[model samples]
Target: MRLTALLASLALAGCATQAAAPPQPAPKPAPVRAGLDPSFELDAFPSTYRPASSEPVAIVNATILTAAGPRIDAGVLLIRDGKVAAVGRDVAVPAGVHVIDARGRWVTPGIIDPHSHIGVGSSPGEANGDGSNESGPNAAGIWVEHAVWPQDPMFERALAAGVTTTMILPGSANLFNGRTVTLKTVPALSPQAMKVPGAPYGLKIACGENPTGGGPGKPGTRAGGMLGYRTTFAAAAAYADQVREYRRKKDAGQPAQPPRRDLALETVAAALEGRAKVHIHCYRADEMLQMIDLSHEFGFKIAAFHHALEAFKIAPVLAREGIPVVTWAGDWSGYKMEAYDSVMENAAFVQAAGGMAAMHSDNVMLMQHLNHEAARAMTAGNEAGLRVTPEDAIRWLTLNPARILGIDGQTGSLEPGKAADVVLWSADPFSVYSQPDLVFVDGALMHDRARPPERPRSDFELGAQRRPEASR
Candidate 1:
């Protein structure tokens, strides 16, 4: 009995000792990155975007504009698992799915802005409002996402305008402005939290007068601008060659020192490799042609040309090259020599010539009415004896911009296997009086006009409506 008691006491004492000791920390998880290329994957800046809804939802009896297909009258759209499950007139609503009646309403895929500077350019006339024009003609090392202020009030205004996705780019102050970031227009604390998952990085380039300051050692002319691009690209190509050789030698079990990384050259190398889409801020048609030549010289493709005032002149060329033109709807004329040729029919002419044309709002005020802007372009085209349908105009605001950002497969159109970014309108989406009654991002009801609180405001704008004297 003494031995038995002694053994039990020993077991209890051992258990107590084990419990008193500090616990071991769990092993850190491996980093998440898009690829094995160190240049692309710096850290695990994972998206913190949580969908507001994961359950099945149905929006029925509405005039649906699929963006990718013909419009459906009295149609039904289905959402499940944060994606568009099905969309058409014959789509059946399954049991237990939350239904949104749209008997007298219209439904369309959410709008996409191809060129914008909402987050990075915080406010006009403010000291820190600019994104990056810091001390060099070539500042490709910086990324616009890093400069994004997610709490910018412009994002909420864009959401109110049915802008589900936007490409926030650096201003065209440098020859290479930097990387552009695509984000979902959801209210979030961090830019990473708002990043559109799997979206391609965009490299902003410039042509014509933007980069030329006519100063000493500056790209004062178009010829000098081309020379600047060529010199920088040659250096970048050499760096890329050295890096590739190092990787090759290492893979073959040879000891080789890796080349020192240059962030500016790294961005340029990515563009040369066709990993980053090129967006050039060009206006005149001649400059556009010169840029096309420059792209050929560098062996990189230009994905789109923003604010191409003379795009109508090069519509056929752009169409043949498979490059998109992102331009304003009717905001043109007499601002500069380059801006003099801008016509309201630029978008229409581009579309008619078999090129993708998107109506982009370069200004903050213009972005909020992109649909109306598209309407004006459509009207101009129709009045000029062109056949521009409402569906075609809707595509200008939706699919074309999505294509420009290289995210058409995900959220641009109302199709199966795409993200359920949708908007329900109180009337025809193009109508000036029409407003979004409900907006959804990735199957989540992000904004409902009936609920005022659903519309989010920025931290800076909190209590902004009250009289300043009273608050003080």
Candidate 2:
């Protein structure tokens, strides 16, 4: 009887399950929102640079200007695997390392030029030689690296002058010239090969006379220039907002369309986001203040001012805002009205006001003599009653410029664990007669005065050498 009752209960349970309501349809996954195209990414053209092979070596009995600290006399600098292994008065060298007897020589960190146009504005001065200036005044989409002619002979000349790295910027003939590329002054076939790996990109913005009188359709007055900047930055900010909103919606599992990508706006938006550095070419103090106001209005930071002839006038303002000035050393003024008020002690005055200052070679010829530029600035500072030593001035050539270029962590000084980009000078580096006896980039002996290259590094140089005497 109990077994018959259990069978009846099982039948009832089966009937109740069949009577249950149909299950609800499975919820569909949130529609996938497409992200920005990979091609539109800022790093689409990634760096392919690799440091040259380096060897373990040591140099002893030298006067070392570390750039990060006080100079060391009778110092020792050790290089291993492309990085500085040790630097001090008593650094111990490994038994198998090759030691250089650097008696009476001066060693310092390799020079870095914050502003240059070497590869873009190449030598020979032919019709097609210059690719630095674009036809239009707004060229935010352009990248200087794409037009760099690595065969420019100026690179070798700059290397011989102890310039291991340089920021090759676009000519300031536009409101927004373009993106700047930092390159290792190496003899490579392509700009990508000479590009400094992982270096941040810089946007070249111009103020004052250059952009105002750039060309047809450009802003014709200073106020017009400011209006142009305001207009462009406003668009960039709006685009940035769209990007942020798209990202936010995507993160929240909602469907959102990616904004139409604009390469010009992309670079400016990157600057607005602080993902890229802003390097403005401003001359007058009033314009610099206007730029500062513009930066505040748009919520971006100016990395450094190039050719800041009136930087001394607003040194305190620049220092308080943490902006650096990349200017010429000597009196390179009077050609233009805006440049007429420049003083030789600009760098010294800026430094005295607790602002960062550096010497930049804007000309190709000047790039080969950045050390002399710093020397001139040092002399001017001394003449002005400011005690600027070799130790202090070396920073203008090496570390301060490096800071402006945003590569101080990797190089710019002879610190342990930094890139072994160093130079050996025959005498006091500040003296006009002093020359780089040897130059090393990433611990690779790239230039040696004693054993110069038998053939030219640039193909153009080779062609010129082979030309007939009449052609010359």
lDDT of each: 0.85, 0.89
Candidate 1 residue-wise lDDT, 8-112, digit = tens: 999999999999999774443343233434334444466666666567899999999999889899999999998999998898899999999998899999999
User: How many pairs of residues collide in each model?
Assistant: 0, 0
What ranges in model 2 sit over 4 Å off?
Answer: 1-42, 126-131, 467-472
Candidate 1: the clashing residue pairs are none
Lowest summed lDDT over 10 consecutive residues: which window, candidate 2?
A: 31-40
Which residue pairs clash within candidate 2? none
1-472: candidate 2 lDDT, tens digit per residue: 9999999999999999888969665454454423344123547677888888978989999999999999999999999999999999989989999899999999999999999998888886733355446566679989989889998888999999999999988888889988999999999989999988889999999998888984686888888988999999999989888888877766665666677878888899999999899999999999999999999999999999889999999999999999999999849999998999988889998999999999999888999888999989989989999778898899999999988889999999999999999999998898889899989999999999999999999998987785566666
**TM-score per model over all chains:** 0.88, 0.91
